[model samples]
Target: MAPLNSHSYHKVLALLAVIVSLVVTTTHASTITRRLETIPYLDYTGIEAAAREAISDTLKRRGVDESDLIARELLGPRQLSVTVPSCKKVSKRKEWRDLRYNEKKDWIRAVKCLQTKGDYGISPISDTLYDAFTQVHQTNWTDFHGNAFFLPWHRWFVWVHAEAMEHECGYSGPHPYWDYTLDYKNPTASPIFSTDPEVGFGTHGNIPLREIGQGGYKVDNGAFANLKVNLPIPHFLTRNFSAWKDWDPERHWGTALGGSFSPEQVKIALKAETFWELEAAIDGLNLTTFNDPPVVPSPDTPAPAGIIPLAGIHNGPHFFNMGDWNGPFWLLGTDWFPAGVVAPNDPMFWPHHTNVDRTFWRWQQRPGKQWEFNGLKGANRTDDPALPTDLLPFYGLGPDVPVALTLKTENWPMCYTY
Candidate 1:
């Protein structure tokens, strides 16, 4: 080989750097995929078999097979055909910890920007557009929870929040989700709660409030520490981290509050057969009374009647992070996340719910399960079918869209993926 001139030598060096960069990027991506796939999901062979039998029995009673029911139910009122949008491009959402530091900072900036923008004059309690989102949720709280709308409605809600952050605040970072399973062992110490001034959402509340009990502390560090929220009366942001407690073998599986959202729980939720079962599992509404061990409160805190021990994978993070543990009596007037209605007040709500939506998306990807939706409808939780034509009103954040449009994330308007 002839000796190369300086120009050729520099070109060769640049080529080598590009190849190394590509290799590292590919390796890192693979590692993330592997870590997610290898999570040890819980084995519930007996429960799963029972679930399948129950589904078969329900189909028999309805006098139709599963395929025929799904096909007929999906074909909603004719008007819905006019509303669905065409997909232009699909975007990938990443786990919060997977995002680069700058991406995290950008997301935080957009969220803060949203806090300053004025609302569309819809909600009396809303001081800004951000508060309006919370108001919309709070107003429809009863309708959205413990029913068919839980998963689909939240999928749309989180997407709307992301769209608002992008259009109104000029945010361009990839949508991120908090994979609670990663922090199920020790959530307070997770990077999601970092005190880092630039990227952290902030740690658990530090200033104690007597009204909210032991877990109620005003956030005192990180990017959103100074953030103030309006709705049900204005107040600075707060969080009551579920205090780490000893594991009771007879009562629960994991030690800390995070254990409620462990990988095993999520895996079991993903294994649900029907949309009803999936929603119930993800929302911590264990249908089978015998499978999950009851959560026994400390002797000092008497367990109330009808108190279900499991918080489900979806509710676990919200309850634990917001320090909304049940005691002898449930407290009132606090804006803690476990209240469910005012959960969006906390910045953590976005990523937390994003992870939830991600779980729903994962379950949807199962063979022959993408369009599997069924459950009670309306605040009454009656037997009315949750049709695709059912409207998901945005309260001026976006168009009132059909539930069908929100089903497949890769479809138009909701063109995004995990």
Candidate 2:
């Protein structure tokens, strides 16, 4: 073959480079398109917006410190739900991406106050978010998990906690939820956890010798530094990611982000045609009754012929953030991130449960399914029947609220829709 001129060879190389670039871009776009199809339209839009904001916010404010701004908010007001002015219960729990500038400040200020409220006597018991966590943690051994009350019980827990932030901590915005599935591919880097110092929750920290997977680090920066989690003996919030041994991080985008659960699973759970289907998928509960033992089904368990198997969306964030399947399962005792009892100590617990509550609220919005019940009894105690009129055992809301009242998303005292 005749040798080509230098210019001809250079031209050939340039053409090859362009072709490769097109192939790469096209492949990336196609992958995103396929993943977007799996998410429900509303969730897809929210997730995409959050992802973009995470990138943009990081770039715009990187390396700039806002500790002074945070300090000012902390010193401003000791807003507690008790003394704060009474306001209408908000019906919208907007996604993090949709929050206004002032709204973000309100959340940061309120959270900081709740964490620091230990100094105040506002909440007969320490006056901090930890107060609520302890209440739930102390009683978690009961029938809350793996039962019908899982949804309603948590719904009550998060609502009251938000109120504490609002009424006690002086925060003025509705509680926010972290849709982990939005950045299921890269949760550690999600905008919700951005290290912006103003609105961010600070990125995960380095765990000296135990940094095993994608998200194994103690969150030791931003607004939640030196947090007095798990009271009496305070501890900083930590996170570690774990998943199946054979999982391919590249192929399994959603569940791959340290959670055994996936965005596809959440989508599947949302597709539940009936309340029974939604219940089973949400908590892995037995469809017939609420008396069955909580089933945390094997990673490989399949849904029955017709019903969508337990999606583990509820269990996903728990295990994703708590269980280091590849390492020691941190469930209790030492750290706030591990175990069921103390998991709520981590600030992430509020947003995590908020997402779960959002899922339940979304299910309730399905056509003609406003008030629905599938599993057996109402309360963890056998005394309560499976009646809407039965009262939930949740306290701290002044007078005990009824199951009938808690069931409706827009009812009195309970007014918020995800």
- Clashing pairs for model 1 are 205-217, 284-312
Candidate 2 residues lying further than 4 Å off, grouped into runs, are: 1-90, 118-129, 208-216, 231-233, 242-263, 284-311, 323-329, 332-340, 377-385, 395-398
Decoy 1 TM-score against native: 0.71
Q: What are the lDDT scores of the predictions, listed in order?
A: 0.60, 0.50
Candidate 1 lDDT over 1-418, as tens digits, reads: 1222334323333443343233222222110111111212211222122222332333333344342223222221122223333456798999998899999999999998987877666468666878877777876565677668888888978987887788778898899998988877777788888889889988765677554434367777998886787655566676766443422334353545565678877887788778877877776554443222223323222211222244667666665555322221123434443333667778888898898899899999999676556666642333455543344444444444445556678855567998
Give candidates' CA RMSD values in order. Answer: 19.2, 24.1
In model 2, residue pairs whose N, Cα or C atoms come closer than 3 Å (at least 3 residues apart or on different chains), thus clashing, are 79-168, 79-169, 79-170, 80-167, 80-168, 81-167, 81-168, 330-339, 331-339
Off by over 4 Å in 1: 1-85, 211-215, 243-253, 288-308, 323-340, 378-383
Each candidate: how many clashes?
2, 9
The superposed Cα distance between candidate 2 and the true structure at residue 222, in angstroms, equals 3.1
